[model samples]
Structures are given as C-alpha cells and as structure tokens.
Target: MKLSSGTIRLIIPAASLALLLAAVFYMQPRAMSYTGLNLLFNLAIPIALATIAQMLIMSINDLDLSMGTFVSFCACVAATVLQTSPLLGALIFIGAIAVYAGMGMLIHVRDLPSIVVTLGMSFVWGGLAVLLLPSPGGTAPTWARAIMTAKPPLVPMAIIASILIAAVTHYIVMRSSFGVLMRGTGGNDRSVERAGWSVIGIRAATYALAGLFAIFAGIALVGLTTSADANIALRYTLLSIAGVILGGGEFVGGKVSPIGAVIGALTLTLAGSFLSFMRISPDWQIGAQGAILIVVLALRLALNRLEKREKHQ
Candidate 1:
C-alpha cells in the first residue's frame, strides 16, 4: 500500500515522537510514569510555542531571525515589570507586538530581505534585554509560576498544554478564512492583491500574531525557570526552525503544519532528555539534535522523490 503525501508528512513526526518515547522508556522504565513524563516534557511548552511563532513567520514565506531575542526580551519584561507592575508589563508587551507589525510593514514597503531585517533586529532586541535585566535575575509573576506548575490528574500538564496550543493554532492558521488569505499572500502576493486583498495588512497581522505567540513562549519559559536571562531563549531560534522543517514545513512555499510542529518540538525535547539520561555531555546535545533533524529531513526528501516517481509511472 502506498501512503499519500499528507499521510507521509504526518507519519514522520508521529513516528519520530514514538521512537523517542520508546528509547527513553527502554533506557529507563521509570520514565514511563506520570512524574517521569512530566519531568521529561516540562520544558516542551515553551519550545512548542516558539515553534508555532516560527511557523507563523514561515506561513508567510518569511523568517524571523529575531524570534529568540524577542522571546528573551519578553521574558525579561515578564520577570521584572510583570512581576512588579502588571499594567506596565502589559503595555510593553503590546508595544512589542506593534513593533513586530511595524517590521512587517517596513519589510513590505522597502522590499527588504526578511532575513537581513530580522537579523539586525535580533541585536537590538538582545541589547534591550541586557539593559532591562543586566544580569540573570528577575522573578516570574505568581500567575506565571502557577500556570507552569499546575498539575492535573491522569496526564501531564505539558502534554495537555501542547495539545491545546496545537489545536488552537491549527484551527486559526489552517482552518480559518483569514488563514487562507495569509497563506495565499505568501504563496502569491500578486494574486492576493489582484483579488482585492491587502497583502501588506495580512503580512503585518501575521507578524503581530507571531509576536503574540513569542510572548507566550517567553512567559512560559520564565514560569518554568522562575527567573529571566537575556540569553535564556537564544537557542530557540534554531530549534524552532528545525522543528518547523522536521514537521513538514517548506521555507518558501507557505506550507506548515501546526500539529506536526508541536509534535516535532516535543520529539526534539524528548531526544534531548534521552541524551541527558544517557549521561551525555551537554555540549553534545545540540549536535545530536542536528543529527536527528538531518536524518528526518533526508527521509522526508527520499519519500518525496518516491512519491513523484510513482505519480509519473
């Protein structure tokens, strides 16, 4: 029996996640318990959210090099102002979203490369984060801590949250009319404009949505850590990119899968934990992640080629 392209795409991430779980359980049977699962997936929420943010950018055929720094900046605000002055923190977050929207507008108006613009903004965000926190010390608000630490019966909160995030994002981005327009804008801005839609507005709205998700990622990170550091989420940029690609996203085609992206993030998270359980060095974890990504992508490429050959035959 031959699998369709959609089935193949879904299967890859699902199989990767299953394999990671199996490996972890084989190494440590105790890891199959609720407590063990919670510990293993505790940090996955932020990574999943970050991956969604990246997915939003990718949906519009753009990249956000500043995503990690922006997340760190939001974490700093959550740690400081959100803890001390809720109103001020809310305003700052809103302002940050506006800035992201403005970036989209600027990119569109100036016909600038998204990569170059976002890369420059990464330094700006990093500098602001440093000025805000200076050092790695700021407390997460009570609400943030509460949300991150909440536990429910029968299942881990991390899994529940990931499911909810994926569901909501999938509905909004893949099942809604506005989502269609945004994706169309990416797939063909000229066609979207010909249809009397404002491509620029769609792009800006997408960027704003990405900013909102990044804020969620930052807050979640702070909640889990109970503190903030400018560099805390710096590695998320690459991780998010890898998750999107592993989840069957194309960099230039406005194609992405919300459920797959979350699954991919969870898979990477578990793979990292698996390495830790094996007593591997921290430095090797990144390399291991890259290796896993490469393998999955290679398999996906092979599958695509096979599908094409079958179609031709």
Candidate 2:
C-alpha cells in the first residue's frame, strides 16, 4: 500500500512515542500511576513550549541558535524583575520580543544566514542573563508558581498543558489564514511577495511568536525550579531542535507540525526518564538521546524511500 506524505509524517512520531511508552512501562510498571506520571511529565511543559518555539522558526525555514539563551534570559527576568517589579518585568519581556522581531527584519533585509545572526545573538542573550542573575537564587513569582502547581482533576497538569499547547499552536499555525501566509513566506518568499504579501512582516511575526513561546517556557522553568540561573536552559537549544525534527519538522521548506512537536518532546522526556530508571549515567543519557534521534531519523529515511517506491510501482 502507498502511504501519503501526511501519513508518513504522522507515522514517525506516533511510532516513536508508542515505543517510548512501551519501554517506560516495561521498565517500571509503577510509572503508569498518577503520581509517577506527574513526576515524569513535570518538566514536559517547558520542553514542549520550547519545542513549539523551535517549530515556529523551523516553519519559516529559519533557526534560532539563541533560543536556549533567550529562554534563560527570560527565566532570569522572571526570577528577578518579575518577582520584585512586575511592571518592569513586563516591559523587559516586551523588549525581548521586539528584539526577536528586529532579528527577523535584519535577517530579511541583509539576506544573512539565520544561523550566523542567531549564533551571535546567543552570546548577547547569555551575557544579559548572567548580568541579570549571577547565581541561581531568585524566586519565582507567587502567581507563576501557583500556575505551575495547579493540580487539575483526572490528568496531570503537565499533560493538560502539553495538549493545550499543541492544540493552540496547531490552530494558529496550521489552520488560520495568516498561518498559510507565514508558511508561504517560508516555503517560497518570492512567490509570497508576488502574491502581495510582505515577506519581511511575515518572518518578523513568526519570530515574535517564537519569542513569546520561549518566554512561556522560561517562566514555566522558573516556576518549576523556584529559581533561575544564566545557564539553566542551555540544553534546551539542541533538545528543541531534535524534538522538532523527531516530530516531523524539516530544516527547510516550511514543513512542520505543532502536535507532532509536542509528541516528540514527550517522547524524548520519557526516554530520559526511562534511562534514569535503569541507572544510566548522566553522561550516557545525553549520548542515549543522540542515539535515539539517529535511529528515528534513519527510520524516517527508510519510510520515505518506501513511500517513493510505492508511488513508482
């Protein structure tokens, strides 16, 4: 039977998630319990949000090398200014979003590689975060903590939040008319320009949206930890990119999926937990993640080949 591109995309994430779930359950049956699930998924909200942020940039055929530092900066702001001066924190966050928009504009105007621009911005963000919080000691605001600690009925808050993130982002980026335009700009800027749209504006809006999501991720991280550090979320950069790819996003051509990204994040989160349950060393955990990513990518490649052969036949 021939599988369509959409089916092929869905298969990878679905299969990967199922396999992870099976492995986790097999390794520890107790993980099926509510408390265990809560523990496992506690950190998923922030990762899912970060993955969405990465997905937004990937959807535009661009990448934000600074996303991790940018998120850490927001966490620093949340821990310091947001806790002490709410008004100031709001303004700072707004300024950060504007900077993201400006980066998009600069990239478009200069026709510069997104990687080069964002890589430089990463250092700036990291420096600002260090300046804001030299140590990991600031507290999360009461409101932020309350939101993160809220216990909903039947399901864990992390799961609920992940679902909502996936649903909301999917609607905004995959269903809305404006979404089509944004994706069109990524898929083919010249074509979109000919269609009477400002490609630059679309790109800027996408970056701003990504920044907004990253802010949510940072705040969530602070809420969970009740503190912040300049280097707190540095690992998120590579993890988020991996999540997007595992979830069926491409590096170019505007191919991306919000739901898949969330699923991908969840799978990776579970993979880490599964490894920890088996007493894997922290050093090996990172390597395990890389290995899992490689295996999934290889599976995706095989699926693509199968699809092509089926079509030819």
Candidate 3:
C-alpha cells in the first residue's frame, strides 16, 4: 500500500535521522553508548530551539532574517549582563521580545516585507552583540552551566530537552486555539480579519513568542559553550530554516510540524557528527552538509510525488 503525502512527510525526517545515525554508529562504533550519544547530540539542543523559533515565524508565512544575529545578541547578554546582573538581563530580554513584536506590527501595518524588516534588524542586533562582547570572553552564568552539564537518568539532557520542546511546541502550534488563529493569519489574513480578530495583534504575539524561543536558544548555546561570541550563532539563520523545511514545513503555507522540526534539528547535529567521524575537513563541513541536505530533500520530494500520484489513482 502506498502512503499518503502527509504520512510521507512525517516519515521522511525520521528515516533520514535513522540512516544518518546508523552511518554515524558505523563510522564510530563507540558512539553507540549513552555517553557517546550525549556527546554527539549536546549541541543540538540549542539548534532545535532555534528551529522552533523559525517555525513560529514560518507559521505566519514570514521569514526572520534576524534570527541568527538576534540569537547572538542574546548569547552575548546572557554571558555578560545576565551573569553579572540577572535583573538587568531579564529586563533587556523582555525589551528585545517587545522589539520583535513591534517589528511584526510594523511589517503588517506598513505592508512591508518581513524579510526586509528582519534583515535591517539583523544588522542592529549584530551591532549590539559586538558592543556587548567585542572579544568573545564573557562567561556563562553558573546556573546555566550547571544545567547544561547535568546528566539525567534514562537519557541525556539533550534528548530529553528536544523531546520536551517537541511536545510543548506540538501542543502550542497544533492544538491550541490561539495557535489556530496565528496559523490562520498566515494562511489567510483577510479571513482572520473578517472574523473580527486583529491580524496585527496575532502577528505581533507570534513574533514575540518566536523571540522568546530564540532567547532560549541563545542561552542554551552559551550554557553549552561556557562563553559567548558576537558571531557565535551567525550560522543558525540558514540552519534553522533548513531544519524547518527538512521537518516538512512549507515556506508559504501555514503547514508545519513541531515534532518533525525537532527531529530534523537532531538529524542535522548527527550529520555534523557523522562527518567528523568520517574525518572530513572542518572547512568543507558546511558545504558537505548542504549536499547531504539536498539529497535528503530530493528523496523526500520524489516520494511525495509518488504518494500524490497514488492518491489520484
């Protein structure tokens, strides 16, 4: 029996993850253990959070070109201001979230392209990050470092965190009434407005939520690394988008899967580990990852076509 396109979309990410994981195990047999798994996946926690943030923006059919830079700015704040004065840092983060919400309102009210607005914000964020930590030597907060290093029973913190994020985001994006309105705003803002809801308000709220998640991503990254750099999360912009699409999210539609995005982030982390195990040079890793991701997308798209044809038959 042929699978439906929706089923195929759900299966592709898991299958890619399994295949990549098997490849990793084959390359480094020692990585089969819990310790090994933890080592390989620890970095993925932040990435998964970032992907969720991106998915939130995509839910409204908007792209955030500022994601990476904003995350870097937050990491800088976490390492310096947060570590030194918790209250100050908390206020700053709140302000940042408000700024993000304002950006959404600006985009909606002015009929501006989200890309352009976020792109300008990217420069602003990057500049702020540089001002915060010019030399990349700030320390992570003691509490954050402790939490990142914690070894829980039954599984590593990375896996546990990813699973929890998946579950929470799934409920928020797929189950909640507010989530329905948020997504509907993306699918058809006119309908949402006609229904007597404020499209601007929904968009603003969604952007604020994305900012919250992005802040978490930055904090988690700084925790794992024990330090912060202005350029630390600069690559996350493209990486988060890739993870979202890998997890069956579309660019223009309100269609997205939180669980799939989490798995996709994990898969990306494993892919990086697999490459390292294969002894690929560090300089080539990014390009190599792109090639691997392309192959996975091609296969998934081919399967999706087949499934659609089957449905018509």
Indicate which candidate wins on lDDT: 3
Model 1, 1-313: lDDT tens digits are: 9776767778878887898899899999999998999999999999999999999999888999998999999999999998999999999999999999999999999999999999999999999999999999999999999999999999989989999998999899889998899888878889999999999999999999999999999999999999999999998998899888888888987788888899989988998898888888898988887888888888888878877888999
State each candidate's clash count. 0, 0, 0
Clashes counted in candidate 1 amount to 0
Q: Could you give candidate 2's per-residue lDDT for residues 143-177 as a string of tens digits?
A: 99998988888898888898999999999988998
Q: Clashing residue pairs in candidate 2, if any? A: none
- Candidate 3 lDDT over 14-98, as tens digits, reads 9999999899888889998879989999999999999999999999999998999999999999999999999999999999999
- What shift in Å separates residue 100 of candidate 2 from its native position after superposition? 0.5
RMSD to native, candidate 3: 1.4
The residue pairs found clashing in candidate 1 are none
Candidate 2 accuracy as TM-score: 0.97
**Candidate 3 lDDT:** 0.92
In model 1, which runs have C-alpha deviations exceeding 4 angstroms? 1-4
